[model samples]
Target: MSTFEFKKNIHLIKILNLKATNINELIEGLKKIPLNSVYYHTHRFLKQHQSISPEPPNDFAYWIEKALNMKKLSEIVASVNIVEFNKLWELKNKYIEVIKKNTIPYERKKKCNKNEEFVFMGCKTFIIPTGDTASNLPEFYEKLKIIESSSIYFHIFESRLRIDSQINDFQLWLNENSYSAVAEEIGKIDPYNMTVENLRRKILNIIEKHL
Candidate 1:
């Protein structure tokens, strides 16, 4: 497999270790990663691994299990008890059983190639890369990416980056995830033809419709 197969962190350099006493703590603990880091990873992931359309992703639990090299933890997560329980702490308890000592920490890597994108399991925050044309105009893009309250914000960010990258990431992600119909409804925007503000408006508009 290529090095690209694994998602790497590049935007933010702060490495955080998480140990949760409660669901609230867990939520806050995960938030330390910062918006820039979160955006970086989400964009990079979408760019590097595009499928045809979007769907629910099996997020952090599985990634952490793999990154930490915890086979047992992964096996438990794969089981369907998650279907029966509906509480955050209920789910947290299962994970805590494995990492009570907090030994499995992954470093937030610094300085990935501009050609390379960030990946997350993941973190909170939206990050614009130095190379993103929109990022050049922080006055506009910052307001767009900072995003006060919206799950679709990330979706917008991912779509924006996918369109901006001018690469095959989104296509692969869509195909891999089996989200074919959604792509047909969406028109492509060439990053080359777009100005920073135009790009921002384009993605924000696209995400808004979905939200």
Candidate 2:
């Protein structure tokens, strides 16, 4: 196994709030943040789609590396054949090991900016500063403009249902974490009837008020 490789679980996205300055610290931070999706909808997606996934191991590598810019680690995972694994845990262990080995020291890269706008599932949110200030209101609303123009709220969920369940799992995760209120607001939207723009507005509205 390469030293730069570690076992990966998309569930890590649920822990994105953990502060880390480097890959090594991020791994440690993840260890402390309990996983919210280990036995959640992930199982359903795997059981229904593994045999049909379009090169799942490679696809998995692509997204993880894209999120973190960890090329070597993705390369290692990209080489595996999912068909050979008898169980998900086996593959999961392989990913975990990749993270374990990926500890070479480097400048800490914050995976997300609390102040910078976060666009996920085509909805927008930001790191709401603790206190209100006249200066922040304008900048915060500007983030809303970006979301109003573009949002992917339902697209990822509907699309990834074929290959991955993380999209749905992430929504469930938000409900359980700090975004519980926002998640509740999202839950009330009727995906069957709403347009992408409508869902985007609902999510952004929640985030705008809270967030």
Candidate 3:
């Protein structure tokens, strides 16, 4: 049988030339920005706050609330379920749809200060092997407890975007190995709602039980 070679990623943040001071410009930028930029904004919190998961607000929603002071609109945008969409474009469209639908006639005219403009940022990911391979469920569970939280985040969240698949790397691997029940339980996890450390614990518990 083939072994699962664990991998980890490091993301370098790049500030794009795009910035938006008003709702109209923000929508335009959203429509045209690269999918990597979209992934960065939506998943930035998850990547940065591996130990602390908050109410789950993307950069767009945060700027709308803090900079523009659109409390209601920001709330609606923040509520975009990051886990629901597998494709980056689908997530981007949902954000544009929500923001466009919520903005009033005069809301488009609202603008923040020059310094408060929403600056678009994207990340360049470098995936490297961790040299940890698991030949079976027991080995997988043992390695899971010792790997970095970022590795957990990569396999669970970033892998979805990388493969454009609904299932994460762990789930996919498990299912491929005929561990369908374990994969299903892992799929039940909501990656956005908990810290990466907590997510690690949850996955360990599921695999440990099956072992």
Candidate 4:
């Protein structure tokens, strides 16, 4: 990722900021920023760092992170609506479906137009999408701009849903742990003498942590 270049051209900047103008002016303004700066800023703004998961033996998390990072990278490349980059958009849509399906023992294998597999992932495989390496970077970047500024809000909603899903998973784990502990305590009690007040407190504590 590159650094964000601060522009000295106030008029160009104003034009870029104007919603009434065509995006060409904004693209021109963005070009003034160094390539490295633009790359770095785009990555940072898109929250690329949070994409990675530290968990081992579940490299899907890591792969998903990288795929999302690549999406961000692609957005930077196309600088227009990502849908304008048909291949990238299609790949991204498929990847999202794969994630949402959460299927077991599934794999994603990428085949070229000639039917040659360029990237393949098994049940535990981690594969990053790669294609169109020879495409113009500036054009890609333009498509990314459109994606970043898209008004449809699907991406934003998807991100929020992912967060909610994580929270739910954590809650389920806590419940499982709490139930195990409660079972242990019940085993020590006399017939019909078990109390749930202690378990309730533990459950409350878990809920509080999430809140």
Ranking by TM-score: 3, 2, 1, 4
For all candidates in order, the CA lDDT equals 0.37, 0.40, 0.89, 0.27
Q: Order of candidates by lDDT, top first?
A: 3, 2, 1, 4
Per-residue CA lDDT of candidate 4, range 50-101, in tens? 2353222122223223443324323333332222222322434433343334
Q: State how far residue 138 of model 2 sits from its true place (Å).
A: 67
- What's the distance in Å from true for residue 57, model 3? 2.2
**Pairs in steric clash, model 3:** none
Name the runs in model 3 displaced over 4 angstroms: 51-56
The TM-score of candidate 3 is 0.95
TM for every model, in the order presented, reads 0.24, 0.29, 0.95, 0.16
The clash numbers for all candidates, in the given order, read 18, 19, 0, 22
Cα lDDT tens digits, model 2, 1-211, are 1111111123223323444434455445444433222222123233223244433333334444655666776677565543344344455555556656653545234353343222111112222222211123334334434532212432223332323443343245454455566556655554423344555567667668864
Best by lDDT: 3
Candidate 2 deviant stretches above 4 angstroms: 1-60, 107-211
lDDT of 3 by residue, 1-211 (tens): 5589899989999999999999999999999899999999988887667644453468998899889998899889988888899999999999899988988758888889879999999989999999888999999999999998888888999999878999999988999999999999999989888778889999999998899
Model 2 TM-score, 2 decimals? 0.29
Q: Which window of ten consecutive residues has the lowest lDDT sum in model 3?
A: 48-57
